[model samples]
Target: MADYEERVKLVKEQLRLAIYFAREFMDVLGKEKALEIIEKAWIKYGADNWKGRLQGVPPEDILKVMGEWFKAQEKVRSELKVVEATPERLSIEFTRCPQYDVCQEMGVPEICQKYCDSDYGAATLINPKLKMIRDKELAYGADLCNHCWVMEE
Candidate 1:
C-alpha cells in the first residue's frame, strides 16, 4: 500500500539521520559514546514501536501478525526470505536490509550494527513468552541475517 511505502521511506530517512548523528557524535565525543548513544536510543525506540504494533494482539497471534507485516515489507522493499512461519515459531532470512542499503549509500555501513541490535529489545517487548535469536546480521558483513522467533513455555 502507499501508506506502507511512506512508512518505509520514513524509516529510511530516520536511519539516514541516525547514521549522520552517529558520525557527528563520533567526531566530537568518540566511537564508544557514539555507538552507545545510538544503540540505546534505537533499543528504546524498537521496544516502544513493537509494543505499540503488538498492542491488543494476543500472544499466540503475535507472530502471525508480525509475519504479515514482514511479508508486506518484503513486497514493499528489502530482500527477505520467509524461512518458516507457524503459531509457535517464525524464521526469516534477510539478504538485503534497508538499513544496510542506507549505510552503503551513505558510506557509513557500520551503523547497521547499532540499528540491528534494537531487535533484541523489541523482541522482549513483543512477548515475554517469545524468544528471538539472531546469530548473524548483514551489517556485520554476514552473508545474510537470520532472525528466528520461538514461543516459549
Candidate 2:
C-alpha cells in the first residue's frame, strides 16, 4: 500500500488531468451541458453493466476503449479551439469512454458529476488508492473488483 502522501500526490495529478479535460470539455459544451452528459453516463452504465460486458471481452478492452475515446474527444475539442466560429458546444462522446462509468464511481473523472457508486475500489492500481465514499450515503460503493482490467491512461 502506498503511503498517504503518495496517494495524495497521485490524486492531485489525477485531479489536474480532470480539471484540464473538464475545461476543454466545457469549452466545447458549456459547464452545464458537460456535467449533464457525464452524469447521464454515470447513471446508465456502471459496474453492474461492466461485469456482464467484460465477461467475454478481454480485460484490456477497458483501457483501450477509454484511452481511444478520450483521444478522440481531445482531437475534436482542440480543433474547435483553433478554428473560429466554432459551434461553441462540444459534442464529446461523454459516454464513449470504455470506462467513464468506472471513472465516475471512483470520483476521478474530469468532472465532479456523481455516479451510480458502482466504481469504488474497482481499480487495480499498483498501489492502494483512496476511494470516494459519500459523506452520508453508502448506497453503491463496492470494493475494487479484482476482475476489472486496468483503465487506460
Candidate 3:
C-alpha cells in the first residue's frame, strides 16, 4: 500500500502544477475571468479535500477532481474563439500607477496601492474591460468576469 505521507506529497505537487497552469492561462486570457476560474478551482479543491479528511474519501478522489477541471479547461481551449480586436473608443479609465498594476493607463501613481484613478480609455471588444491582457497574439478568448479582472481558461 502507498504511504499516506507520499500520497499527501503527491497531492500537493499536483495542486502546485494546477496553479501554475492556471496562472499561465490567466496571463494570456485575462485577469478578471481567469481569477474566477482560479477561485472556483480553489473552492472545489478545498471542498474535495474536506470531504477526504472528514468523510474518508480517498486522496485520489481529490486528484480526480483537479484532473477533471484541467480536462474541462483544455476542452474549452480547443474550441476558443479568437476575434480580431478593434481599438477601443469608449472613455477609458487610467490607473494611478502604471507599474504597480502595470496598466497602460496614464499617470504613474507613486504608491499604486489601489486601482486606476482616472479614465484613459473605454472598454472595447479589443481593449477589453479586463485589467490584464493575456496572449497579445490571441485576439480575445475570455475576459475578466469580476472586479475589473480576467476570466478565461
In terms of TM-score, the best-performing candidate is: 1
Off by over 4 Å in 3: 1-12, 56-153
Q: Show pairs that collide, candidate 2.
A: 28-89, 28-90, 29-90, 121-144, 122-144
Residue 46 lDDT (model 2): 54
Candidate order, lDDT descending:
1, 2, 3
Screening candidate 1 with a backbone cut-off below 3 angstroms (N, C-alpha, C), the clashing residue pairs are none
Residue-level error in angstroms, candidate 3, position 124: 37
TM-score of 2: 0.32
What overall lDDT goes with each candidate model?
0.79, 0.40, 0.33
TM-scores of the candidates are 0.82, 0.32, 0.28
lDDT of 1 by residue, 69-98 (tens): 777776755567788878778899987676
lDDT of 3 at 12: 49
Candidate maximizing lDDT: 1
> Which residue runs does candidate 1 get wrong by more than 4 Å?
1-12
Tens-digit lDDT track for model 2 on 7-83?
44565565555556656666899877876666555445454454554455454454444344445545643211111
Model 1 is weakest, by summed lDDT over 10 consecutive residues, at: 1-10
lDDT of 3 by residue, 1-153 (tens): 234445445544544455456557667887657655554544454444434543543432433343343444434343222222222211112211113322112122211211211111211221233233322211111131111223122
